[model samples]
Target: MLTLTENASTIVKTLAAQAPGSDDTGLRISSTNEEHTAFSVGVADAPEPMDLVVESEGARVFLEPGAAVALDDKVLDATLDDRGSVSFAIGLAE
Candidate 1:
């Protein structure tokens, strides 16, 4: 149930396209700790078999099972810098 802002969606699409991946390319978020507070971000060719796929505005996000539950009510936002770098942030959904 994670929602993505327009900016986030655009950035995700761009990143996925730039990576060597198939049409299902997307941002993959996975928890690194037991508490699920910290996460690793990367572009993946496709979701894992157990991943929760979230899509918006043609943008795709694959979340690990734990990450999906932790972010179930969260919103994703992103900002692109002048240097062509992207940063993603998460927050509680309104």
Candidate 2:
């Protein structure tokens, strides 16, 4: 399960809109053990393995099984800065 904020909502829309033609596109949020700390956006030629499709008010998030583990019980969100740009964050429940 996951939650989407307004800022995340906007980013989701932008990514979807960026897809080629009318092709369906959405956000894929994952947690990796690799030493990388950033989100990614791209077009997939086909469905990915162990991917969970999440949707909220026209926004979507694709999560891999392994990544979902770290995201479990965590609130996935996106927030806007003073510059009006958006960024993503995850919060674990206390």
| C-alpha TM-scores of all predictions | 0.97, 0.69
Candidate 1: Cα lDDT at 48: 99
lDDT of 2 by residue, 1-94 (tens): 6667666777777767777644447777655555334445443422367887767778767776656655656666677779966677777655
1-94, model 1: which lDDT tens digit per residue?
9999999999999999999969999999999999999999999999999999999999999999999999999999999889988888999999
Q: Best by TM-score, which number? A: 1
Model 2 steric clash pairs: none
Checking candidate 1 for backbone clashes, the offending pairs are: none
**Which 10 successive residues of model 2 have the least lDDT summed?**
38-47
What TM-score does candidate 2 get on C-alpha atoms?
Answer: 0.69
